[model samples]
Target: MSQSIFILLILIPLTFTQSVRGKDCVCDLKNSDPAFPEKKLKNVETSALQCTRTITSEKMTDLDRLMLGLQQRVKQVEENVIVLEKEDDRNLYGAVSLRIIELEIAEIQDLLNKLNRTTQNYHHLSVQPAAQLEVMKDKMAELEKFDNMQVIKTNRENERVKRDLEQCKEELNATTAAPPTVLPARCGLGRVVSVAGPRTYSLTVFTSYTYGAWGRDAQPAPGDENKYWLVVLSTSNVYGNFIRQYGTLSTLLLGIGPKDTYISSTNPTTNTIQGPNMVMYGNALYYNCYNTYSVCQFNMTTRAVSTVALPKDTGYSNKFPFAHLAATYAYTDMDFATDESGVYVIYATTSNFGNVIISKVETSNPPVLNQTWSTSLHKRTATNTFMVCGVLYATRYLDQETEEIFYSYDTKTKEERFDLKINIKKMQTNIQFLNYDPRDHLLYVYSDAYILTYELIFQ
Candidate 1:
């Protein structure tokens, strides 16, 4: 019976141990149930993945918007660069125009300064005139005190002196009335040895026209001896279509008695004057024709216009102007000069390599080019030129107040001289026009609106 009881206890303990192991196995299996905590963990992982995907998509969209804005900014910057470039080009052009205007202003200022200096000189002379007037009054008072008895004896002596003066004046007048000595046909006055005083000076009526030509007619008709002609470049200081004639020097200085002869009412026409280089001779005006390499002659009596074409390849229209270091006189490619011989046109030609070329112009109905002369001197080097006894004299800028006659070319002997040191005293900086008047043996200078006359002394 004791053995049976112990076997029972062992069986009970085995059954208990089996029950504990089974229960533990059930608890472990519950943790791995599909519909329980495992399913819940899978749903939570899906939710987190969806949230991450949404956030990534939104960030990519924001990056796309930022790239688009950067592209627009780049386009705007390119457009601004283009506008700036155009503005820079316009500014550069404006600067060039301003430079030209500045040069013109400087020229005007120089002219004003010259005028001021002349006024100051006149003021000094005027003071002397007043002082002289006072001295004359005092002399008159002293003369009045010495009258009465001295007066009768003085009158008798004066009458005797007057009779002797009258007899002497008659003899002197007879001698002075003798015929003048005739000169040679070509070089009538001979070589110019010296230039004498600027005997006369006057301002033009239109002083504002800074460039012009004015002088007495080189070959005037019988009734027009005292007549003077003027051509003021009324258009841009370059062109005019009229010639002004004054009866006398008094009328010219007074700006009265001007007879305007219009070559053409419409300027820049076929017969209009193109530049300041002009001459009135034989009742005709000779000048450069508008827009042509030719010379035009307008007869005052007949109102006829005649033109003669220059040589082939003749430079004109500012091609070969009177140039110097300081400035250039534009459209002065053709210059009309007259001397004892006749009218001549001074110009340069491309075929002659820009050297001075001269041609004689016949003063007939249709003026013809008679003879052509070429010189080695360059046209641009000369500031002005004139003809004297068939000799071409070229002047250069020496100083603001002086011009040097440094070169001459004689058509008679084909001689060239560069050593002539004859100097011209100038009242201004530039001589816009210069011509030698054979009638009075005078040099007519039109310089910055002042008309000056200098006598020529010939050997």
Candidate 2:
């Protein structure tokens, strides 16, 4: 009877507690509501708006802006090319055209770099919420396609411009005839003489000048070597002197005298600043400037001078105005020479396996580098170089009286001959510069302070 009473007491309290809890839960539920679905909807709408704004801002700030700039640059290049094609003077044309092409190339490279960055940005943004970024991805894909097409177009145009430059060079080269395979036997140094006058200016560093017939067979009356055409550098300007040859029978007179001197109105000051290496072809005087790494030309008729820079890293040592006997063999870096074909610049290059680089100067007024050849032999291996036809003959001195013409490079055939052992007999002296006069069939060599001419008597 006691166990039944205990069980009744437990059942009555459990029932009463259950009824009170139900009433409390209903009262709490009616007091407030969480509204989770409404909060979620508001957050999603805000995210979508943010994504749309970002897409619009990025489109304007990134790929679209770069593409617009690229288009403008390409258009400018095309217009410049058209203007260049119409230019009559080769000097101005080549300079302007090459500059335009270079600018275009740089622009294309910049655009490519920007595109690469844009591609990376696109990938970064791709991992964002798919629903919000889907449109952005599509837009980016289209921009990428457009940019690729433009890049390809610019590259093709760049190639076309390069081809045009080559065409211009070919046209210039065609203006002159090819040189002979073998030169005459009496085509070397000859007589030496001196000038008679009062020295007002110094020829100490007067390195650049032309010593050749102005026109075809333009020689002074047989023995009238006293009065001749002269273009030499002075302290003030590059003066043209028509003076008399004087001094004793043993020593040859050189340098410009005080009489009959006139400054080259166009190129006078340009060449005077630095000692240049010069050559004469027909009516034009070609030279390589020391201060500037450019080959310059002076038109004898119009008195106009133009210049074009040499290829980079060609080891052009513009030191000491006069020749240095001590460093003559060591720093024998650059020399300007002319053959029957045209003018050429010979120098040792640190690049291209330390090769001797020979570049042909086209007939353009500024002189363009038409064809180039790299010799396996080092340039300093020889004391001097003279181009015969298109072949380069390197001379190495054995002693005061002996020089071995042991190296020959044929630019046309691309052949190197090391077995050639032609011996040249001369006094032991540093030969500063040498030129083969096609008109008189003699080699003019300048050594020490004397100008000597020799006859090239080949066996």
Best candidate according to lDDT: 1
Each candidate's lDDT (Cα)? 0.76, 0.51
TM-score of 1: 0.60
Please, what are the lDDT tens digits per residue for candidate 1 over residues 293-342? 98998999888999999987999889999989989997899999999878
* Residue 89 CA displacement from its true place in model 1, Å: 61
- Over 4 Å off in model 1, which ranges? 1-188
TM accuracy, model 2: 0.44
> What is residue 121's positional error in candidate 2, in angstroms?
92
TM-score of each: 0.60, 0.44
In model 1, residue pairs whose N, Cα or C atoms come closer than 3 Å (at least 3 residues apart or on different chains), thus clashing, are none
User: Candidate 2: global Cα-lDDT?
Assistant: 0.51
RMSD in Å for all candidates = 44.6, 27.4
